[model samples]
Target: MKIKLLRAATAGLFGIVLATAAHAQKSGGVLRVYHNDNPPSASLHEEVTIATLMPFMALFNNLVIYDQTAKQNTDSTIVPDLAESWSWSPDNTVVTFKLRDGVKWHDGKPFTSADVKCTWDTVTGKRDSGWRKNPRKEWYSNLKDVTVQGDRQVSFHLGRPQPSFLGFLAAGFSAVYPCHVPGRDMRTKPIGTGPFKLASFKSNQSISLVRNPDYWKKGRPYLDAIEWRMVPNRATRVLAFSVGEFDLTFSQDISSRLAADIKAKAPQAICELAQFNIQTQLLVNPIAPFDDPRIKKAMMLAIDRKAFVDILSEGQFRIGGVMEAPPEGVWGIGPEQLADVPGFTGDVSKNREEARTILTELGYGPDKPLKIKVLTRNLPIYREPAVLLIDQLKQINIEGELEAVESSVWYNRLLRKDYNVATNSGGSALDDPDVMFYEAYACGSERNYTNYCDKDMQARFDEQSSTIDPVKRKALVNKIDHDLQAAGVRPSIMHQRGNTCWYPYVHGVSPPQNSHYNNWRFEDVWLDK
Candidate 1:
């Protein structure tokens, strides 16, 4: 039902609220959290999943950061991190940031504008030696060059004006890397100027981050350390949290049903439910039978999207297009408009009938069913929806076998186009069109796992990105979303509404309303107990 934010009403049981400015912050306690899976790597730039961001985001600082104190992150709430101040040139094509002096990397290396240049240069492919994979390189396609004025000043020259450029810098993945650290080393041993330092990252065991004592920000990172125990199973993670084994649950890791179970068991636990703006989508690879446009169209027509929301999320999730649906989302199409988009009509029976008819026309029916393996990540969130997708495909004579893989192997298989059909989740760091379209939909985008590239749609993406007027830009964005659905480009099932619970003793932690990525820097988080 489009839940923006729902908190447990029994406040007296906990007797404590999230730490406000007036509250006295307590420090010197380890915030033990349950991590869902082992991340592919520690490098934020190279990875797409929240597995990496949930643990490692605190280990680095961006040029700008979303105000951690804000309940919702907006353009106005973007505050400085490493950059003391920023300004734009006359035409808005060039933006510059004045560095924060006395800031040092976790390893005690002085932070400078050159490090900023090196970071973006590595992202934009100016330097070849650093990055193993530039997944979000398309996020900086408009960037002409990064020029350093001095040790403290840096300017980014954009080929065209982008209104959301500042927001991009504030994302967790946009953390500025140290110039001296090689990209390969970043995957395991990384260095940054954030409030926390990675003490150790034992794969499949735990990730430990200690407070950066030499952190530039004064009297910050109140917690002594943050420890994330990698527990692959969701039920086990939730069970442990209910019994006070963990101070906090992973970001958006708890389902609606699981939240209820936690409340029943641990009555004092604070549960915050909201739409994380992450969508579960079906990625259809261009293989022999699936390569045909008619086959793709039939595939899109077959499933029931509403069943996913009802069964998996207990009617808490919302059916949406590529962009997150409105209210929480800034640029998404409304329900009326989204219904008109192909496969989103909410008429599952009618849609499936059309799909079956198409299958029959293609000489496939109950006698000759299309057998395929539906690949999904070996996690509850991914696997559950995938199983539902297989059930729905059966209506149209598609015999689907579920193949769940590890997070690392799953991402690699998608990168190599190693699956015929897969169900996965796509998350955007920012709600802006530039970030969403370029990273996931654009031609040659590293994260474009489906390899569905339309030249016309790419041109339209640029048009909306360059359009300065909000109304005009939104119209263009809606058109792109419509076209994307019509073409069946990684057809989105539904935007997820997940729950995250934490004990009252954990203070100053703000769960992001729009994204699962940002607001994770636990610099201000403290332990009241």
Candidate 2:
């Protein structure tokens, strides 16, 4: 059965109301939340990491949102947020949105349709013409123009109809902001038409937000305020939660083992377990002997996915292509097709034996070994997996040391292509394969840390992105998934299955299957205590 929305009154299937079986809503308590990190900027137009994005989730709203309260099958559907309703042209090239009339910015400024037009321009890199580092600007490649039609309507002209344009709108990168404020100004102080107003913010520490007194939707945002605390160390955060210092910790902020601790100690807390699209991956840069295809294939054959699932996820994970297996009925390679790929053959012993043979043939049988460092982020969760990867590489005569760097340094090295073989995490907020391919694997894409540039891969990615028909697109997507695995640049480790917890009284929050930071329904969540 689908998890019903705790409150479903203000909006439809997209709305949140007190579900018949859930507790009645209460309106005036402060919700204390524990998070992993603080954002470099609260504005939507910035390099967004899951760590940095968690603390400021309540301060902004996207034009379109993936409905978290919807059933697993329909969860990715585009729903109203700042945009109340919208329509597309007969040719599908133009999308026109009718903005909600009564919405007001946190400063009491009327939120006109022009803000929508300007926000898109900022995200697409039109607002800051020479600034090239907008990490998510590539999401709007199909946009030809955005024009304000009237006081309440705005229209978007696309270069071509992207079948999954809604997926772009639903991304956290698509958070809408006021047209009046300078984009840089928003980095320190943000103002938006969301459920909360930023009361105080300190980078890398904590953020506090108070209820929007005149929030567009009446009688909503059941909590009066929120205090989001950033607890970077995993063990420290678990201790804080156990001592009743926190009300909730979203998925990325907590690991599986810690969740079990919460369930045991804080037995009254509600722990929700689900698999999100986040994946652990092994990205081996093609340098020195790594450039040899045999070495690449051998590296792919070294690890056991089932073991990683047991080690990291506690057996709650799913292993598949670059994308996760679709429990949401989204198009993805089935189990049999997944087994035929290079690294996911379902038999760890057989794959390891073949891997050792390849390494032995290349004159590395442990006496003279292939040594490299597996660079990973300093987080315990990531380091734990990196150590396992080193152990796996040992079976194939590859001696490795675990190198842990801070988050900033870790990402900079990847952008500079300075690492050899690294264990990393990468995935799309959207279920659509086009979103994943364009963001991560497309040639010269900023997120393309592996330096993978192949014309055949590009062609397959492009064909799928442009195909509007679901059936035709699914065929191309499955083919691309197979080719990505067959080429062996980055091998999917496992789709992370972790738990998020909240006090039983923290009602109305239903996290999305993917995009842990995307669908922030904090406005709908309230405290019954």
TM-scores of the candidates in the order shown: 0.95, 0.91
Q: Show where candidate 1 strays beyond 4 Å.
A: 1-23
Tens-place lDDT per residue, model 2, 427-459, is 566666767787778887777889889988887
Residues 55-105, candidate 1, lDDT per residue (tens digit)? 999989998888787767667767777876777776878887888789898
Model 2, C-alpha of 205: deviation from truth (Å): 2.3
Q: What does candidate 2 score on TM?
A: 0.91
Deviation from native of the Cα of residue 352 in model 2, angstroms: 3.1
Candidate 1, residue 63: how far the Cα is off, in Å: 0.6
Specify the highest-TM-score model's number: 1
